[model samples]
Target: MPMTKFLKNDKGLTLIETMLSITILGIVMLGVMTLFKQAYLYTVLNEDKTIGINVARNALMYMEKQNFIEIKEKFASLGNNGQLQLLVCEHNGSARYTLIDSNTSPLSGCSDIQINDRKYNVTIETEPPKNNNSDYANYFIPLVVKVTWKHGNIEQSTQLKGVLTSEDIR
Candidate 1:
């Protein structure tokens, strides 16, 4: 255990070498953690988009199945820029439908829709038929279904367009 014998022991790492190794490992781990955070963020964003698209499609389908006569009566009262009434199904897997008038603010009653802790707002707008298509102008009901939600600080939305041929129209 003399000084000369201890200094000759090259098999073990020096104190400086061990500290440098730990510092490098820490830097590499920090970069890896950053990548994981970004991946999770993108995954959640994509999930919200997919759910928004599903909500829009379901709303469009529901409106299409209803009697055009009754729907016309509802829209007729509002005239131009009439928003269709959206009834969201039960939030807890029940088929119950609740009517929410689009004339009010989207953040009103529709705010009850919450999935995975995210609140979704759905709105349907009736657009006038295109000028180029005169035949459709009389017989077609142009509709746009938009589903909006807040993802963190940004508000994200998706829309689906559909045309319903009216049998009641002359």
Candidate 2:
């Protein structure tokens, strides 16, 4: 009879135990949600950075392909106080490039670009080869290209530098 009474005393779960399990599950779920949020943010940031890099690279390549002599002549014609301008834009999901001279009165071209509904600003700065050795100055020109854009109220930028050598003129 004592064995039968002991077997009948079994209870599935107490109120306190049920509440405690619920609380633990809630905490774990909250942590997992936080992790997921962080991962999403990281992915967005990476995408933006990748686009900026590509813009800068394309600008560099465009400059590299130009005839150095004609570039120099164009600069001279502007009295050396002008800039070589490149405008990049997105049209129907494709990028288009336009080259212009800063001296032109209607100079509407800017380094800013719009890609995939996002706006990015790109700037290219060139330095006439340093005159350390007069001959070396004639042989190389230094260039820096920067890409900038806004990300969630914060500004981000990427820069690339290269030297155009006389040997590349051909």
lDDT, residue 151, candidate 2: 83
Model 2, 4-104: lDDT tens digits are 87567676777887999999999999999999999998998799899999988888888777766665566556553456556764556765676566445
lDDT minimum window of 10 residues, candidate 1: 104-113
TM for every model, in the order presented, reads 0.67, 0.69
Off by over 4 Å in 2: 1-10, 74-82, 89-96, 102-112, 128-131, 150-156, 168-170
Number of the top lDDT candidate = 1
Report the Cα lDDT for residue 64, model 2.
Answer: 73
- List residue ranges in candidate 1 displaced over 4 A: 1-12, 89-94, 98-101, 104-112, 150-156, 165-170
Residue 19 in candidate 1 has what lDDT?
100
What lDDT is reached at residue 170 by model 2? 42
When summed lDDT is taken over every stretch of 10 residues in candidate 2, the lowest stretch is 102-111
Q: Against the unseen true structure, what C-alpha lDDT does each candidate score?
A: 0.75, 0.72
